[model samples]
Target: MVLPHRLSPMVSAFTALWKQRASLKTLILGDFTQNYLASYLGFAWAVLGPLVMIGVMTAVFQFGFRAGTTGSAGIPFPLWLACGMVPWQYMAEGFVTGAGAITAYRFLVRKAVFRMGYLPAIRLLAGSIIHGILLIFLVVLLFCYGASPSWHWLQVVYYFCCMFLLLLGAAWCSAAVSVFIPDIVSVISIGVNLGFWLTPIFWNLSMLPENWQIVMQLNPAHYIVQGYRDSLVEHRWLWDRPLLAHVVFFIWLFAALFIGAQIFKKLRPHFADVL
Candidate 1:
C-alpha cells in the first residue's frame, strides 16, 4: 500500500510540508513566546542582552584595552560595530541552531511522517524577530548620535533579505551535515566564536594592509558585515559591492543550497536509524 511519490524529491517534500505550514507557524510562534516572552520583560532581554554586551565591549575597548578606537567616517566605533554585529547575531543563531535541529527534534525525525528538509527554514523563522528588534536599536543609536537618514540607509531592507537568503543556504548545509556528524554542532559553535574575532566586526577591514583585504573577504560573513556597515554607517547602496565579492558570495550561496538539498534528500531516510 506504499505508493511511490512521482514528484521530484524537493517538490514532493514541499508538497508534504505545505499543508502543515499553518501548524508549523503556530508551533514556532508558541515556542518563541514561551522562550522569550513568557516572563516580565522577557522578550526585552533579547535587545538588552546584546546592547549590554556591546556597551561593555565599547567601554572595554575604548577605555581598558584601547582597541578598535578608530571609526569609519565620523561614526563611533560602537555604532559601526553594532551595525555589523546585528546581522551577525542573527546569522550565527541561524547556523548554530540549524546545525542541531535534526538532533534536537529527534522525536519528529523518527516519526517518518514529518518533512525534515524544512528544518533550516524553521530554524530561522523566530530569529528574524530578534533581528528586527536589534535593527531598531541600531537605528535609535544612530539617531541619538545625530546621524541623518539618507536614501542609502533604506538599503538595509535589501541587505536584510540578502542575509536571510545566505542564512537559508547555510542552514541547509549545517542542518543536513550535523545529522550525520554530531561533532559539527561543536564545530559550528567554535567556528562562530572564532569567526567573530576573525571577521571585521569589531575592527574595520581597512586596518589590514590593502593587499590582504581579499583574503579576509573570502569569508561570506565578511560581505554581510561589510554590507551592514556600508548601508547604515557609510551610506552605501546594495549594488555597490565589488564585482569579485558578488561573484564569491553568489557562488558559495548557490553551491550551499544545491549541495545541501542533495545531501538532505539522500540522508533524510536514514535519520530515524541514527536518531
Candidate 2:
C-alpha cells in the first residue's frame, strides 16, 4: 500500500534502516565501545556510572530526606526507587545522547551513501547496552530485598519498548533540529534534569491528590516510571492501570513519533548543508 506523501519520508527512512540492519548493529556496538574506550574501567562504566548515581540518590532521599519510610506495595524504598530509576536513566541518557547523535557524527552526515537516519538509533541502542546491565542490577537488588520474581516482571520489556519508541521519535526530531539550532541540545539537557524531579522517581503518585494525580500522569515519563514500579514492586499488569493513563501515554507516544518523524524528514535534506 502506498503511504501518504507526508509519511513516505518517514516510512522510507525506516525501510532503509531495516535494509542495513547488520550495519546498524555494528555501528551501535562500535559506538557503545568507543563511548568508554578511553576510560580505565572500559565498558564497566556503563554499569558502574548509573549504579553510583542510583546509590547516591538513594542515600540522599532514603537516608538524608527520610524518604525510606514510604514504600510502594511494601517493597523497600530503595528497591522501589531502583525500579523507577533504572528505566529513567535509560530515558534521560537516550534523550541527551540521541539529541547529539547527528552532530557527533557530522562526517557521516556529509557522506552521500550513509543513512543519517541511523545516527539516533545508534546512540539509543548503545545506551540500551548500559540500560540492560543496570536492569540486571535492579533485579539483584530486588531479590536481595526479598522481592521474588513473578510473571509481571516480563512487563519490563513491554515498558522498555514503550520508552524506546517514545525516545526514538523525540530523538529524531531533536537530532534533526539540533543541526540548525545548536541550543536545542542544552534545552533537552535542562528538560531531562528537571524531568527527574518532576517525575515520581523518588516519590509515589499516590502522594498527590486524586485530581492532581491525573494531571501528573499526563507526563509521558510518569507512565514509564509508574509502569516500572507496577511491574516490579506492585506486581501489576499494564492493563491493571487506569485505562485513561494508557490512552494518554500512547497519545503522547504517537504524537512524538509522528511529529518528530515529519520534523526530521522535513529538516533532513538540509542537515548536510548545516553540518
Candidate 3:
C-alpha cells in the first residue's frame, strides 16, 4: 500500500520546512514591513491597533455591562484585557487569515515545486511576529502602571510555543479545507468571532457557574488565557503542576496536528485543480 521513496517525501517535506525557516522569517518581516511602510504611522499601528481595540472593549465592558472585573483596581482592567487579548488576537487573526492563505495565492500554488502548506505557515509566522512585538509593548505599558517585570515573565516563550502549535494546527486544517470549499472561509470567520466571547478574555473564568466552569474547561483557549494570566498577572510559575487538563491539551494538540497533517496531505494533490 505504501509507495515508498527511498526518502519518504514527508521526511523530505519536514526537512524542507525546517530549512526554509529563513524563508518563513523573511516572508513574515517582509509582509509586515511593506504593510506598515504604506502608511505614515507604520508599525505604530501594530501597537495602536490592539490598544484601540482594548480601549473600545474596555469602555463597552466597564461602562455598559460592567465587564471590567479582571485582577483589581490597582491593575487597570484594560491592561488585564491586553494581557489576554494580545495572544488571543494573534490566534484569532492567524486562524482567520491563514485559513484562506492557500486559495489566496492560487498562482503560487500552481507552481510545480511550491509547497502549499507553507502558505499557512508563513501567514502564521507573520502574525506571530506582530503579536510578539505587541507583547513587548504590553510590558512597557504595564510598567507605566508600576507593574514590575519579573524573571517569570520569560515563561511567555514556552506558552507561546504551545499557542503557536495550536494555531498552526488549526490553520493547517482550515487552509486545506478552504481550497476545496470556499465557504469554509466564511464559517471560519464566524467561529473566530464567536470564540472571543466563548473564551474568557474580558472576564474571569473562575466567575462562571460551577457547571459552566467545568464545561468551559475543555476549551484549549482557556488554558492559553490562563497561561498568560499565570505568567504575567499572577506572578507565578506557568501551570505549576500538571493536571488532567494539561494532558488533554497535549492530546488535543497531537490529535489536531496528526489529523490536520493527514488532511492537508490528502487534499494537497487536488489543490491546483480545485483552486
Q: Rank the candidates by TM-score, best first.
A: 2, 3, 1
Q: Which candidate should be chosen as best, given lDDT against the real structure?
A: 2
**Sort by lDDT, top down from the best:** 2, 3, 1
* Candidates 1 and 2 compared by TM-score, better number: 2
Any runs in candidate 1 off by more than 4 Å, and if so which? 1-21, 38-45, 65-69, 111-113
Candidate 3 backbone clash number: 0
Model 2 spans > 4 angstroms off: none
The reply for model 3, stretches above 4 Å from the true place, is 1-14, 33-46, 63-69, 72-74
TM-score of 1: 0.86
Candidate 2 minimal-lDDT segment of 10 residues: 68-77
lDDT of 3 by residue, 132-244 (tens): 78888789878887888788788888888888877777777889898878898899889989989899888777687889987897888877877787788777685673587
Pairs of residues clashing in candidate 3: none
lDDT of 1 by residue, 42-123 (tens): 7888768878878887998877876644556667778877987898898877788878777776877866666787666676
Give lDDT: candidate 2, residue 267.
89
Please give each candidate's TM-score.
Answer: 0.86, 0.94, 0.87
